[model samples]
Target chain A: MNPSLKLAWVVLLALELSFTQVWTVNVVLIVICLALMIWRRVAIKRLLWLTGVPLFFASALVWSLTLQGSASHHFLIVIFTRMFVYVYLGGLFTQTTDPLTLTRSLEQNAHLPAKFAYGFLAAFNLMPKIKAEVASIKAAALMRGQVLHVWSPQLYFKAILTAMHWSDQLSLAMVSHGFVEGAPRTHAAVIPLRHRDWWLTGGSLVLIQVGLFIGLP
Target chain B: MKAWHLRDIILVTILAIFMGVIFFVIGPVYTILSAALAPAGLQPLANEILLGIWVMAGPLAGFIIRIPGAATLGELLGAVVEMFLGGVWGASTLISGVVQGFGSELGFILTGYKRYNWLTLVISALTTTIVTFTWSLFKEGYASYHLGFLAMLFTVRFISVFLFGGVLTKLITNLLSRAHVVKNVR
Candidate 1:
């Protein structure tokens, strides 16, 4: 099993254990996942982008705190901690888990429709390529002395144009490759739940449930 | 499609789950958790205001998907993702998600779901603001805050929505369009 897939199952178990209570534990789990990703040699820049999302929210909370009186400051702190952890966990999971494995697991275990799943899988696979295209577009624009300011409406319009182009090509490619709805296909690999995966999932669940019970009034 | 090819079924399911996890769980949960932890009274108004802004995601989704129930489904999916991942508000997050999506969808519906103009975006922002604020009144006890505080919350929320959901989402969709990822959907 891929290490990232292992991490995702662990996080999912932790989430299920919490039974929809106290987000702090989930946040901690996210941080642990991020550490593991770094250990596994993922690029620092990508990690930074993932972590940066939570930071943006944190800044909003900070701004809110300054404006309002600090009555719920303690509550806010706890929330921020959880948010940061969970976001990183999500980032790590995506970075490490292969989309192919993820798709297979969802189909076999969760009973999702193949047509929708495959379409999305294709879309996910295309994300990196789409990103590269965006970069090239920006670079080309820059060469023509176009300022790529995010705040500008022109930049926004240009981005939409680029996305539409990519989607069209991708859709056409899929159709040409016999990826039509209802087509018969064989699985490339099976996503089995190993002993390690089960143990990790169970352990995370037990720990979370115990913590929540202890914390509750 | 046809009795469901195992490979295709699995692939699509995973993709949906992944997208669900990324958009619904990661984004909103992060925002909600951060808002919940800020220093007490100091953050409530601003946090609520920010929540209003985040809620505009529904209308933005509608604009992109342009399908019936797209806004509602997208927002609800996002909320469910957040809840499953452990949001601070617990079940209450789901309630907010429904109301916010409804509010945004109303704007789209009023525009006949055809126009993606600035007016429609502004209406979407206002609709989200009003609906989300109404929910906060019940959940957060709006009676606790002064009139001035409430006004500030509304203003900040409007500005946030205009900038983030309206401006940022537009920018993202535009990029997607140029790449030909969202063709003929507008």
Candidate 2:
């Protein structure tokens, strides 16, 4: 499926699940997403950690509900399954879709501006450099007898100061490379929204509604 | 807003990407905190406590760029970065980004997008607290909590938002300016 369609499907279902607490639908969604993730060869360890941690927390939530008796059993179930639903739904997207493809699809198919899209792509490519810079900043701070924790402002200030410098140089390079603002350009990789993606998205959405109408829960 | 220079766009993306890394680092802390709070039925507090930090990019970007949609763009891009970095929230991160960014943007809009000061940052934090809290009321089922609990959550959220989004944003911006690092952007 195209990234845009996949994103739309997941986001729509998340919004739907938020408003309604249908555990049956949640179960179906979870099973399908889990299957996809497994088939896609998502690392078993990461999958287990993702779902297992949430499972532990969900059980705690149910236990708290039982002790408090504030909400009913059904609501507890809804909350419990909703956690898995969100995690799996999110995992399906992040695991299945490549970030570069997603950005290209968003820009070409979803009308995202090229400036923002290419800007993101540039920064995304620079992530490794930025990460190294962050480490060096911490090392430099330590050398200066200063301990910069993750939440330290000095750490961010030093890192962002470097970022400001990189951005200026990067933007200048992009412009000198004949990149014009707001001009349409040809794509080296055309991320087209195929008909199958729409069919799958529409078909699943309709199937879910039909099942819901027939009282799947 | 004037036409966005390619430099401005790159600057904002870099800044947002940086904040996204911070958010990613903090993600595990939030997860552990929320799981710990779950047993006490206080998981919501985890979000409230960290929301200010989460919304930091919006106001900080707005202050630096000083454009019409810079706050929203910065926040939305930050969420995008978070997702690409394998954030657990996945697609829903985009939704939260839109809501949080719009909330932050509202503050600057109220100031006519001219005054980038403490007052604007405070207003941005206030709006972010209220907006995200309201979103939780519907999305996270915060409406089910008791009135006193809700009030307490709101207060904590506001304080957190003010401290990180408002106060910390100002501090960082000041530090950047003092070092003469971001003089070219403005």
Candidate 3:
């Protein structure tokens, strides 16, 4: 499937899950996501960790729902459901879609600016490097016998400056290679709008409509 | 570099992506903070207070880029990048980005983009906190809470934005300026 289509699906499901308060519809939606994860061979342990951490933090929410129940308890459930479903869908889409494919799909299909799209993809690529820069900054701070507090403003300031340096360097390199902001570009992959795309989109719409119809009561 | 140059795009993208990562990192911090306060029935306020820090991305972008829409682009790009990185809130993340970005954008706009001072930073932070609180009133059902509780939430959140988002971001921006990092973009 085109990453854009998957992105659309994720966007739709997330919006649908947002206000869906009915337990039955929520369960159905979550179940569908869980099934997809299993089909994709995503580790059950991964899913457990994803769900467990949030639930652990929100233990008070569970306590309130069970003990100090109120009308807004339903709202709580709906919001949590929205959170979990979004995580699952987002995880699925991101895991399957590479940055190149995403940029290509976005440029061809979504009409995003080439320079901007590629610029973003380059930034995404730099994420791992940014993490490394942060680590080296910490290491250097430690070498100097300065106890680098992770939560301290100094650490953030240093990290951002390092990232900015890298960004400036990379921008120059990209420019040297003939990248123009408003210039035209070509795509390697032709993203076709196929039957499955329609099936996924149309099916999601129908399910969301049904969910809303049942959830409103 | 001229205004809106390739360098500007690079700075915005990198900052946005960095903010996206920061947003992810803060998730755990927020969870822990809120959980700690859950026993005291201050969980709602905990998230809001910490949320002040999230506003830093917008103002910091505006401060360095010194361009119209820098704050909003920083915020919106961060949201989109976060969603791409599997943010749990999904599309609502985009909504929050737009709202929060607009709040800071209003701050820069009100000053005619002339002043990049502390007052403008505080205004940016306050605007973000107010909009998020109002958004919570409907989206998170804060309207159902007692008036006293809501007021407390607002107060704590205001202090939080003032400190973390406003003061801390301003400090960091100043540090960058001193380090010559700001010159690359400015």
Candidate 4:
């Protein structure tokens, strides 16, 4: 499956999911999400946390939504079902895909501008290291008798300064490697989007329509 | 350098990654806060407050980079980072990011990207809250509510975004400016 297409499908279903008022439609979508989770062999504990976040948040809206009558109650349920399904799809995507690969896929598949695409990818490469960098910076500050509080503005300022220094060196390296601005770049590999991906996309749309039909009054 | 320089990209990325980690930390707190507030029917308000913090990166990026569309790009990239870290909102986060980012970016655009002052930042954050809340009312069907209830939602959402996303963002940026780290940025 093309990653971008998968993103489109998830986003589309989520749009449908939000407006879906029919209980049966909501149930069907939830079931599909659960099936995906099981098939992917995601641990039950992790699945609980993944789905739990949205569920907890949605529960808060129930009081406000259900204030008047059973209509609001029904709406609340539909919203819960949507959140579960949406979280599952999002979790699955992020869990399975690599960020750098995602940027590359965007560049080739979506024709995202090269400067923006590679620039984002370069940033993605730096994401995992931010924590270590912050820690080291904090340690140095501590050694120098500079107290840093988590909520303090100084903490973030320090972090950005450190990151900016790294970015300066990085941009120079990128330029040195002959990455020119406004220049066309070619992909060494462009994978084909399979027929199955299209089938899934179409099938999901149909399912969503059927859900709306059954679920809405 | 042009408006969207390589350094700006790197800065946005760094800010995005940093904010993503912050969201991860806040996720559980948000859940707990929402649940605690649900009984008072302020859960929605709590949700808005939590979102205010998330939206800050846009204005922060915009103020620091002082470029066209910097806020929107920063917010979008931050959303991507959140999704990467398995944020609970899923695909919805991307939509929220775009809407909220563009919404916040409006304040900067209105100022001709010349004023990164307190008032502009506050307006930027409030604009984000207004934009996102309006969309939520439409999408979540809050139109079913009474006028009083609707007003309450609007007020809470504004305050939350104003304090956290708007004011806090300016505070952090000001600190950065004082430290002279962003000297080369603008």
TM-score-superior candidate, 1 or 3: 3
Give per-residue lDDT, candidate 4, residue A81.
Answer: 65
| CA deviation > 4 Å runs, candidate 3 | A16-20, A57-59, A62-73, A150-153, A214-216, B1-3, B19-28, B80-91, B179-186
Model 3 C-alpha lDDT per residue in residues B15-59, reported as the tens digit of each score: 887666655667777878877877766667667677777766788
| lDDT (C-alpha) at residue A6 in model 1 | 57
lDDT of 2 by residue, B1-186 (tens): 576777888888888887876666787788888888877877777778888888889998888888789999999989878877766777668888988999999999999987767888888988888888888776655666667778988999999989888888888888877887544232
DockQ metric, candidate 4: 0.55
Write one digit per residue (lDDT tens) for candidate 4, span A1-217. Answer: 7877777787777776666567677677677777877887888887888866767666656666777223465666766666666677777777666776677777777777787877787777877688777677668889999876545576677777776787788888898999987788877877467798889888878867875885364
| Candidate 1 error regions (>4 Å) | A1-67, A70-77, A84-96, A139-145, A193-210, A213-217, B1-61, B69-106, B109-120, B130-151, B163-186
Worst 10 residues of 3 chain B by lDDT: B177-186
lDDT for every model?
Answer: 0.57, 0.82, 0.72, 0.75
- In model 3, pairs of residues that clash are none
Per-prediction DockQ? 0.16, 0.53, 0.43, 0.55
For model 4, residues B1-186, the per-residue Cα lDDT tens digits are 246777678878888887776556787787788778788766766676667778878887887778888889989888888877767677888888888899999988787777778878877876787788877875666777677877877887788788777767767887877777655233
Off by over 4 Å in 2: A60-69, A212-217, B180-186
Using lDDT, give the best candidate's number: 2
TM-score, structure 2 vs. true: 0.92
TM-score of model 3 vs. true structure:
0.85
Arrange candidates by lDDT, descending. Answer: 2, 4, 3, 1
